[model samples]
Target: MTLYYAPRTVSAAVAIALNEVGAPYETVKIDFASSDQTKPGYHKVNPKGRVPALITDRGVLTETSALLDYVAALYPKARLVPDDPFQAAQMRSVMTYLASTWHINHAMGGRGARWAYQQSSFDDLKSKVTENITANCRYFEDEVVQGPFVLGNQFTLADAYFYTVTTWLPSDGVDIADFPHLHAYQQRMQARASVQKAQSDGFF
Candidate 1:
C-alpha cells in the first residue's frame, strides 16, 4: 500500500492507524505548502485534490474516516475497532463528528476560500474558528471521551481520528490547556507508539 499524505493534516490519522496495525506501507508526501495537491498529477490519485489518499491492491481510497475504517478492517487482529456492534457504532459516531463538524470548524480558519468568495466573509469564517473549535473541545471533554480513550481502556480508531483533530487546536487559537480532559487525552495519544512512529515517519 502507498499512502499519500501531507504533514500536520488529518492524514496523520490514517498513518497512525496503519502503524497500529503494523501494516507494511510506504508514504508519498503531498506537499500542500507548494500547492502540490491541486496539481493535475495528484488529481489522478484523488480527484478531490486532498491528502490522505491510499493506494491499495484493490484500488485507491480517500476520506479520512473511510481510510481509517479500511485499515481497521484489513487488520482486525489489531482490534482498532470494537467487536461489539453498539460500541463500534459509538466509535463511528465520534469519527463522524470529527470529520463532519470538528474538522470543518478548524478548516474555516485557513480554508475559508472553500466557503466564501468575499474577503470579509472569509474573515468572518476565520473569526468563528476559535469559538467553534473550543465548543467541540468542550463536547469531547464532557460527553464524548469516556476516559483513558474515547471508548474507555480499549483504544479504538476514534482515538486516532480525534487525536488528529486535536492537533489543530493550538493553531486554531484554542488553548488545549483550557480543556483539561482533552489536554490529558492529547498527552496520552502522543505517548502511543503508533503516533510516535507517524511522527518519526514525517506524517505528523
Candidate 2:
C-alpha cells in the first residue's frame, strides 16, 4: 500500500490510473493556496513538494512521470505499461511531451516557475507552450496512438498522462476540437468506469 499526496491538476491522472489498477492507497490532499512545498514538513516527504508524491514501503517518489512509471511497475497485472522496448519508448515519449510541454507552460494562471510569468515574457512563453503542445498533439493524432489508447488498443500509463494534460486546455484557452482524434481519445478515457470513480473521489 502507498499514500499519495496530490493537488488538483496533474495528480488527477495519477490518482485515476492507480484506481484503475485497484491499487490499495490513501491520499493526502495538499492545498497549494497556503502550503509551501519546499517547507520543512512537506519537504521531508518530497523535497520538491510537488503533488502526486508516492509514499511507498521503499520511500517517497516525486515527479509525475516517475510516479506514473512506478505505478505501472508496481502493478504489472494492470498492463498499464508496455513490455516491448519500442512500445515502452513510445509510452515514455507521450508522458514526457505532456510533462515538459503542457504542464509547465499553462499552469498556475500563467504565473509559475516554468517560464518567466511577467507580462513581458508571458505572451512569448505562452506562444511557445501552445506551439509545442499543438505539435505534440499533432504527433499523437498522426502516430502515437491507435484507436483510443496511446499504446495501441492497450490502455497504458500514457493514457493517464494524456487525460491529465488534455484537461487543462479549456482553462489555458487551447482549442482541442481541431485535433479530432485526440479529442475523441479524451472522451473515451473520461467514459471509463474507473475514471468516473476517480473523478467522483475528487480528481476533477
Candidate 3:
C-alpha cells in the first residue's frame, strides 16, 4: 500500500490507522503548499485532486472514513472497529459527523473560496469558524465522547479520526483547555504509539 497525504490534514487519520494495524506502507507527501495536489500527475492518482488517496492492491481508495474502514477490515485482529453492530454504527456516526460537519466547519476558515466567490462572503465564513468549531467541540464533550475514547475504554478507528480533527482546534481559534474531556482525550491520543509514529513521519 502507498498512502498519499498532506501534513496537518485529515489524511493523518489514515496514516495513524495504518500504523495501528501494523500495516506496511510507504507515504508520498502531497505538498499542498506547492499546489501539488492540483497537478495533473496527482490528478491521475486521484481525480478529486486531494490528499489521503491510498493505493491498495485492489485499487486506489480516497476519503478518510472509507480508508479507515478498509484498514480496520483488512486487519480485524487490530479491532479498530467494534464487534457489536450498534456500537459499530455509533462509531461510523461519529466518523461521519467529523467528515461531513466538523471538518467542513474548520475548512470554511481557510477554504472559504470553495463556497463563495465574494471577498465579504469569505470573511463571513472565516468569522464563523470559531463559533462553529467551538460548538462542535462542545458537542463532542457533552454528547459524543462516551468516556476514555469515543466509544469508551476501547480504542477504535474513530479515535484516530477524532484526534486528527481535534488537532485543528487551536488553529480554529478554540482552546482545547476549554473542554476538559476533549483536552484529556487529546493528551491520551498523543501518547499512543500509532499517533507518535504518524507525528514522527510528518503526517501531523
Candidate 4:
C-alpha cells in the first residue's frame, strides 16, 4: 500500500487521479493551516516539506505531476493515461501546462496579493498574472472539445489536475465566466465518479 500525505485541497487532484486508477492506498491528511508541513519529523518523509507526497513501495514520490504519472502507470487497465502516442502526448502536455503554467501563476499571484496586503506595490505583477491566467483560461476555453473530458471523451489525469487548479480562479480574482467551455468542463469534471469518490475520501 502507498502512504499519501495530502492537505485536503491542492492534493485533491492527485488523490482523485489515484482513485481513477482504482489503486489501493492509505491516505494521511496534512494540515497546512497549522504548519504541519514544517514539523520536524515530516521533513524526513519529504525534505521539501510539501503536501501530497506519496510513499510507495518503491520510494517517496514528490511533485503532483510525477506522482500522478507514477500512479497512472501502475494501473494501465484504468486508461487514466491514453494508449495512443499522440493522445498520450496531448495528455502530458495538458498536465504539464497545468502543473508548470497555471500552478505557478497561482503561487505568484497569491504572493503578489500578500505583498500588496503588506503595502507593497504588487499591482503591475498582479496584473500580469491576471492577464496570463486569463489567456490560459481563454485558450482552454476555446481548445477543449465538447466531449466529457480534457482529452476528448476519455477521463485522463489532465482533467483532474485542471479541475483542481481552475477552481482557484475566483479567489485569484479571475472571472472565468468568459471562458464558457472551461467552465463547463470544470462542472463536468467535478461530477465524475472518481472525482466524487476522491472528494468523499478527503484526498485533498
Error of 1 at 11 (Å): 0.3
In candidate 3, residue 1 scores what lDDT?
A: 99
Query: lDDT (0-100) at residue 121 of candidate 4?
Result: 55
TM-score-sorted candidate list, best first:
3, 1, 2, 4
Candidate 3, backbone clash total: 0
Clashing pairs in 4: 8-204
TM-score of 3: 0.99
Residues 72-137, candidate 4: write the lDDT tens digits: 888888888889999989988888888877777776665575445553456655667777888778
The lDDT of model 2 is: 0.77
Q: Assess every candidate by TM-score.
A: 0.98, 0.86, 0.99, 0.86
RMSD (Cα, Å) of model 3: 0.6
Steric clash pairs (candidate 2): none
Which residue pairs clash in candidate 1? Answer: none
Q: What is the alpha-carbon lDDT of model 1 when measured against the actual structure?
A: 0.93
**Which stretches of model 3 miss by more than 4 angstroms?**
none
Least well predicted 10-residue stretch by lDDT in candidate 1? 162-171
